[model samples]
Target: MNTRVNETERKRIAAAISVWENEGGAPGQDSMHHQYGRRIEADHSWTIYHVFTGVPARFGGDAMTGLSRMDATSGMLRLNLRNAERRRERIELSSFRAVPELAECGS
Candidate 1:
């Protein structure tokens, strides 16, 4: 299984996350932490895993995680970016861990 989010999609996802973080988005709800998977070079879809720490205990306390299936055409990284955009709650990340593969992209 080639679970690699291509450079193009990775940047887009990173940008969206940056915006969400800067604007104070909530804990990802159904909007986040959902399991998603994709094979490499199949219909231009990609899969990436995200692990977030420093989240409030109510949300899951230091082990918040999610996966996104990115479409080449639509670029859907998170499960629901709209949900994240609507909320203005803050989440603190003491440490951020993306897939080891992403490190190659310097994410």
Candidate 2:
């Protein structure tokens, strides 16, 4: 399906993602949220893989307004998946912000 979100919904989702990240992600972690999204790889891991905002209809209205939404997020999931030395090294050398070597999901 092609269910895109609006700017308002984007901000809302960003806030929700921030809350989730605050509770689970490590303290003082380097991320694209802090950086200006110069590092695509790093940003991708957080904005795409770790969070649910990347998913459609996970929050806000899903064909209806004023309805509660369910989130399917596994905070820090990728960090555990990519436990390889080389992967970590690549992310580190990326500059701007190093992307976490996010591991795969098991479902």
Name the best candidate (by TM-score): 1
The alpha-carbon deviation from the true structure for residue 14 of candidate 2, after best TM-score superposition, in angstroms, is: 0.2
Give me the overall lDDT of model 1: 0.36
How does each model score on lDDT?
0.36, 0.35
Q: For candidate 2, lDDT tens digit of each residue in 7-95?
A: 77888989887665534444344443321111112223222232333332222323111222222223123333333444557766564
Clashes of 1: 1
Q: Which portions of model 1 show Cα errors greater than 4 Å? A: 1-5, 27-107
Candidate 2 residue spans exceeding 4 A from truth: 1-5, 25-107
TM-score, predicted candidate 1 vs. hidden true structure: 0.22
Cα lDDT of model 1 by residue, 2-107, tens digit? 4465777888999887555433345454545322222233443333223243221122233122322323112223433433544433322212224455555565
Error of 1 at 80 (Å): 23
TM-scores, all candidates, are: 0.22, 0.20
Error of 2 at 73 (Å): 18
